[model samples]
Target: MPLNRTTHRPVSTNALGGLYVLGALLALGVVWFAEHWLKLAPCELCLWERRPWWVLLGIGIVTIVLPKRYARFGVFLGLLCLMTSIGLAVLHAGVEHKFWPSPAPECRAPAFHGGSFKDWMSAMPARPNKPCDSPDYLFGLPVSMTELGGLYAAAVFVVALVGSFRMGRSRR
Candidate 1:
């Protein structure tokens, strides 16, 4: 027997939101794992890349709780958030590749303020300092992690946008 569209619409809509949430969470988990388990530190641009994922996750949560009529809008917002992330990742990757200079001054190491050597050492940030121009490889791949993240964000954006449109049409 074939599945009825009427019966399947809610399930499919909810599934889209759930999948987006899961993807965002997984991306964040990988970043965290790289920082803690692998002992890799994130640069300023790398930290910037995380903001859109958090926004996407919030959008996914809103999509899940919204009324059926508003769910498509939520999904559309997620697509926009993912696109923003892709842009940031691409910029980060470009900085790493030396295509252009980094827009953020924090890409360079922090300068010491006027003080004794011990005072400067004590004032230094605890986090490991990795410059934005340096690339962190993944599994022997030539591309940096930021580049891979941009690819992943692009894929998710396409999926969410297509799914949102399809779900909207199905409701008519």
Candidate 2:
């Protein structure tokens, strides 16, 4: 029920911060569901793309806890983390679409020579190692997870930026 001093409109920085926290949780939840329930194996680049969201969640939590005077700092941190997530998503999508090669060494497939069955089994990892170029679609959609992530991040960034601007103007 906080009123914006400049616009005389009701606004709450905590609400905006909650958007970030919930959005990050939702994203992570979807990925987890896909991995565990759907049995989707994430490639190295895909895993890398998740790092920013984890950080963003912490930023959101801090933003919600901080005083109104310091909330802007937390918002800025969330923005930075979202931007980093978008960048990683773009990189991953590009690799999936063959726009560029993945920079992660783990993305490459291991060369296996002819060996005994026991040796082969021992050499293989317990979980399947997916290649970065292989795309994982959600619900049979044509869009790759990376592309979806990038779009989601961009959307969140736009909303957060606008909300922060509206709230910040009252402080000036």
Candidate 3:
């Protein structure tokens, strides 16, 4: 195979798969660390943001296992997953900024009607105690982690989209 003119190296499906896998793993690891070590619990939106990464990770692994001919399909799937992540991140960021209300009810403070305190507490979901609208900063950074995640996912989505097209053209 000829090397790509700009990169000066042969781009293969395995390489793209490895990049996707590594990127997803690293992102997940960072969130996990924050949640565990830093005691920063994820809200409902935060948990939703993680779904695409999990899917992307699985797609990357499957791509690695399949033959090179099937790699483009995996890349395409990864692109979709990344786009989903980006969209979710954007929504979360928007909620955090108070630009609009969150779609998830958990993001808002629970309304206590005429029920007793114990009844009201029991009615609430056990998980997602943290409201989705709250912004979780990254190590004191001005930007919230959700915004940063959107940016990162957008970058990866562009890279994967370009890489998939290049792979398709190169094969022809």
RMSD of each: 4.4, 4.6, 3.4
Candidate 3 per-residue lDDT over residues 1-172, each given as its tens digit: 9877775344678777887899899889989999999999898899999999999999999888889877778977888899999999999998998899889887777777887888988878777478877898977799999999999999988877777777777765
- The whole-model C-alpha lDDT of candidate 3 against the native structure comes to 0.86
Runs of candidate 2 with Cα error greater than 4 angstroms are 1-10, 111-127
- Quote the lDDT for 153 in model 2: 96
Q: Which ten residues in a row have the lowest lDDT in candidate 2?
A: 4-13
| Residue clash pairs of candidate 1 | none
lDDT scores in order? 0.84, 0.86, 0.86
Query: Clashes in model 3: which pairs?
Result: none
Give the per-residue lDDT digits (tens) of candidate 2, residues 45-111.
8889888889888888888999988888888888888999999998888888899999997887656
C-alpha TM-score for every candidate: 0.82, 0.84, 0.88
lDDT comparing candidate 2 with the true structure: 0.86
Superposed Cα deviation of residue 155, candidate 3 (Å): 1.6
Worst 10 residues of 3 by lDDT: 3-12
Better of 1 and 2 by TM-score: 2
What is the C-alpha local distance difference test score of candidate 1?
0.84
lDDT of 3 at 163: 75
- Which candidate would rank higher by TM-score, 2 or 3? 3
